[model samples]
Target chain A: MVRRSREPVLWAMFSGGGMIAALLLPATVAVLWIAAPLGWVEAPSYEGLRLLFLHPIGRLSLFAVATLSFFHWAHRFRYTVYDGLQLYHLSQLIAILTYSIAVALTVIAGFVLVTTG
Target chain B: MAKALNAGYKRHYPKWHRERVPIFWWLRSASYVKFMFRELTSLFVAYAAGLLLVQAWVLGQGAAAHARLLNWLSHPAVVTWHVILLATLLFHTVTWLNLTPQALVLRLGRWRVPKTVVWAGHYAAWLVLSLVIVCLFVGVA
Candidate 1:
């Protein structure tokens, strides 16, 4: 029997992450970069944001976003190097390194979020 | 005899020259560059989320730590990077919204959802989600 490919699973996460990132990232950037520095809107208080993150929902949300976004980058960058840069010969190594980093970072995010408080 | 047969087959099926892709092939077309840039935005997206993870960690450390993190975020270099991230991510957002219809096709009974409706739906979701996050941060219920 032939082995089944895991590409679908990774692609699913990549596409899901892409959707969420596309929807939410711009607004988040607006608040952090544009609004806070320029005062287009009153900047968020550190304590207030902190308290928000203290909630379980907030922590989980951040973890989901961070992990998903990392996977998205890993998937896209993998293809970029494979096709865009034409490194098909290094496919196995590239996939291993890219996904390992994404998984590692995601684990770090989860650990930090859960244990920090 | 074998050599002669192989030579005849080679002549019958001429191999075409392969075109080499240049290092900067992406620069040759506007659309290719746009697509590559869109793919590149994934890195910025991940970076932003990583910053948030750091923020959550610092927030748990207490006010002093949180304050220090905020101070660091305000540095000139960090601010400049954030600015570039914002611009590129905005481009990512717009392109993503436009491409959603292509990715997801919804049909209601026999009728297909209009592409415009799909685009509008993405924007609407973005608006709602952004409002909720903003509200939560601003201490509004």
Candidate 2:
């Protein structure tokens, strides 16, 4: 809260985050490339370990692009639940819901790459 | 009484938007702008939900299907739109990431939460998430 009241910035962030969320459907197509499917473009990968952090520069770049973008969304969504639902009394609950879902989503991505990878 | 006052504040501000380019005019009235920004930031939730869904679906699909998905994703027109969309979305994320703290705790009686920490924590999380994504994808691929 800015000494007086600062809700506009928050609202802007909310709208911006919503706009960004619109990109996911198309971005999902990139999953094909990352997965190395037969006809896919191979734009990015989320495989695992050796290549994950230690691999060549190319791999690092791909993960960086995908992950950074992902977290940004994570941060944005956490607040959405709180203010959007007017769960005014459930701030912590909303926080958990927001961040946990992000964690779960990212974890699921990792799991898929690990098992199928 | 405080709640009533606050409600009046919202009614006169962004919560009850009266026009189309509220954002454009928002700059004209700093107070209104701030009010609107707070509401707009919620878009991130939508962005995250979309990304997560993509992750789940992509992971479930096999190589062949994944490949087809990529071919479509890479189309020149598609790529252009994707880049434009990503840029705008990131704008949404970065600006809002800076506001998460206050948003999390809009008000706790008279004790309010600081937004700086909220934004910083998000940046930190981005770094960690980035690393984790790198580890998983590079290794698997």
Candidate 3:
């Protein structure tokens, strides 16, 4: 019933890729928290995955972080817009447009990483 | 049978005041607890970025660069920042985990998991995961 009910437009923003990004964030942080002090590798680098940080894996990681982060902000911001701005006519539209840009920017970042790599 | 009173309870309600207001009320509501968590979660953004910078420098110069980055991070100012950011991030992560169920559409048969269960499960998972990670680090060290 809850699912079938008209979900608050703000809630919809979280579902399509936004939720995925939110879920990804903590996992990535946990990984960083673990990877950093543990001396997982003898030396880290900027090169490719095998070589260092500046590599493909690093670039991919950067893009992933940025993309996910944006989506998280987008979803949360939608709620803020909804509650703060009493412009009922425009709230839903703003939410949609915000999420659209967030996803689009995320995609572009992904493209950049893959192409560059 | 209950009699319908024409007048509303007690005193007449005061007229609503009109003026432009600030967003501060948004921060004070109980529901804002979730928003606070979501807002605070942005720390992960900084965490990831910081890690990338360290790795970037390290990768660009090899071992020496990596070592220097580590040393830089160890500075008192940087350490203080890391400590504060780390605390904020963990709180956000934990709160987000707690709220995941409400945000998600999960059902078992006709019954949905209680929000309490959902929140507790997240805390349990986090505890288990963090413990395991800490153990691995300790073992390696």
Best-matching candidate per lDDT:
1
| Model 2 agreement with the true structure over A1-117: per-residue lDDT tens digits | 649643555445434434334333223323332223333433354333223323345333433334444554555555544544455678878666755665675575454444432
Q: What is the lDDT of residue B3 in candidate 2?
A: 71
Q: Write the per-residue lDDT of candidate 2 for residues B57-132, one digit (tens) a residue.
A: 5544655665565576567775665555445445554655665665566557896656776566667765566555
Can you give the lDDT of residue B102 in candidate 1? 91
Error of 1 at A85 (Å): 1.6
Overall local distance difference test of candidate 1: 0.84
- Candidates sorted by DockQ, best first: 1, 3, 2
For A1-117, candidate 1 gives per-residue lDDT tens digits of 999999999998898888888887777777765667666667687767876776888888888889989999999999887778877789999999999999999889978987987
lDDT of each: 0.84, 0.48, 0.55
Fnat measured on candidate 2: 0.12
Residue-level lDDT tens digits of model 1 in B66-114: 7787777778787888889989888878888889889889999999999
| Each model's DockQ score | 0.57, 0.12, 0.22
Per-chain TM-score of candidate 1, chain B: 0.82
Top-scoring candidate (DockQ): 1
Native interface contacts retained, candidate 1? 0.63
- Model 3 Cα lDDT, one tens digit per residue, B1-141: 122564455456688686755656556777875565556455354445446544544445555665666677556676566555666665666566766777766579999888878777766766666665444333433
Number of the candidate with higher DockQ, 2 or 3 = 3
Extract clashing residue pairs from model 3: A45-A52, A45-A53, A45-B59, A46-A53, A46-A54, A46-B59, A47-A54, A47-A55, A48-A55
The C-alpha stretches of model 2 lying farther than 4 A from their native spots are A1-117, B1-55, B58-61, B104-118
